[model samples]
Target: MNLVLGIDGGGTSCRAALATLAGDIIGRGKSGPANIMTDLTGARHNIVEAARLAFVDAGKDSTMISATDAVLGLAGTNVGGYRQQLEAVLPFRRSLVESDAVIALNGALGERDGAIAIIGTGSIFMSRKGAAMQTIGGWGFMLGDLGGGARIGRDLLQEVLVAHDDIRPGSELTHAVMAHFGGDPREIVKFAAASKPADFGNFAPLVFDFAARGDSVGSRVIARAVGDVEEALDALKLEPDQILCLLGGLAALIAPQLSHRYRMMLRPPLQDALGGAVSMAARLFGAPKGGADG
Candidate 1:
């Protein structure tokens, strides 16, 4: 029987699903981070590990990996060179590499034309109309991803520093952050110097939690992040009736914070990035004759 694999790799984790070419999923697996740009070797390892586990769960031979077609929607693929490098290393009969935002758009909108804002450790806004697709942000944490969890956590740390130096009024949120570092400013500096986006993103939920409880610093930080997200959405030039889906870990928390006008356009996704990858793979590689649906 013909099989296909769908992968959704992000900064936080990598997920894989084994399915028949007809679109029925047979098994699923998950592994650690797989952001190619940040950690190529690790991403490659995790991708293969996830695929191998999926095959095992499906009760198929591990060697069948070479016979399966795959579609991967991953973070950091938008940057130059990373996709090519990953494609060269991937073991599959056929494969497609796409930006995480593209898969999210596909999953959220299906056959309809619409927009999506993905906010997790990173953020990207995408819109599609027929064959044309446009994107904003998602330049990675350092260069962009302004409304992402990583950025929000980074800003929280900055606020902690400011409060330490008496530049800003300290709040319960800042106090909790300082406590996390043992109340030592130098420790925060040390952490920041060595930390990756995911490390910073670990603090994102705390920021949202504090914001929800009316902490001034947390409210200010989230407000800024929400503003940036709205600005990116505005740049999409969406139609009045076009639906917008908010996707990823931070989506639910950020949804209520968006302006009422934009909130009205928001809708839940029909599927997720992994499902979108499976759908794409099914389109690219048809099911074998007489093969079961899954």
Candidate 2:
């Protein structure tokens, strides 16, 4: 039997699933962060680890990895050179690499034309109209990803610093952040100098939690993030009936904060990125030439 492998590699974790050519899932596995741009070595290791674990869970020999066709939906695949480097090292007979946003859109909408906004440790907006596709944002943490968890957490830290300097009134949220850093501004500075986006993203849930509790600074931070998300959605120019799925770890937390107009357009995803990878793999390798699978 020909086996297919599907991978969803993100800033925070990597997931792998093993399935038959017929699309019945046999097993799934998970591993640590696999963002190619941020940590290439770690990404490579985790991808292999997740795949191996999936095979193990499926009662297959690890050596079968080289015979499996793989489809990877990964963050940073759109960045220069990273895809090529990662592809060169992937342990599969054949592989396809696509942006995480692409898989999110595919899984959310299936064969239908629609849009998806993925907001996690990073953010991106993707839409498909007939045969045409468009993407916005997802330029990584430094340049874009405005409404993402990392950006929200970064903004929270900045607010905390301002509050510490008496430029803004301190609140429970700011005090908690300060306490997390041992109430030493110098420690926060040192951490920021060495931290990655995932590190900053670790604080994102706190922002949402505090916002839900009516903390002033936390509410402001969430509102600003929502505005950025809305700006990206507006730029997509979606049709009135196009289904919009908010995806990623922060999707549920952020959805309620969006404007009423956007909320009205929102719909739940049909599947997830890993499932889309599997569907792509089947399309690429499971059927005969000239068939609908491709």
Query: What local distance difference test score does each model get?
Result: 0.88, 0.88
Q: What is the TM-score (0 to 1) of candidate 1?
A: 0.86
Off by over 4 Å in 2: 11-13, 31-35, 38-49, 60-64, 89-91, 179-183, 290-294
Candidate 1 steric clashes:
0
Please give, for residues 104-158, the per-residue lDDT of candidate 2 as tens digits: 7887888788899999898999989998999999887888999999999889999
| Residue pairs in clash, model 2 | none
lDDT per residue for candidate 1 within 39-139, as digits (tens), equals 99999899888999999998889798988888899987867999999998888877788888787787788878889998998898999999899999888
Q: Report the Cα lDDT for candidate 1.
A: 0.88
Model 2's alpha-carbon lDDT is: 0.88
Q: Would you estimate the TM-scores of all the predictions?
A: 0.86, 0.86
Please give the RMSD to the true structure for each candidate, in Å.
Answer: 3.7, 2.9
119: Cα error in model 2, Å: 1.1
Residue 180 in model 1: lDDT = 88
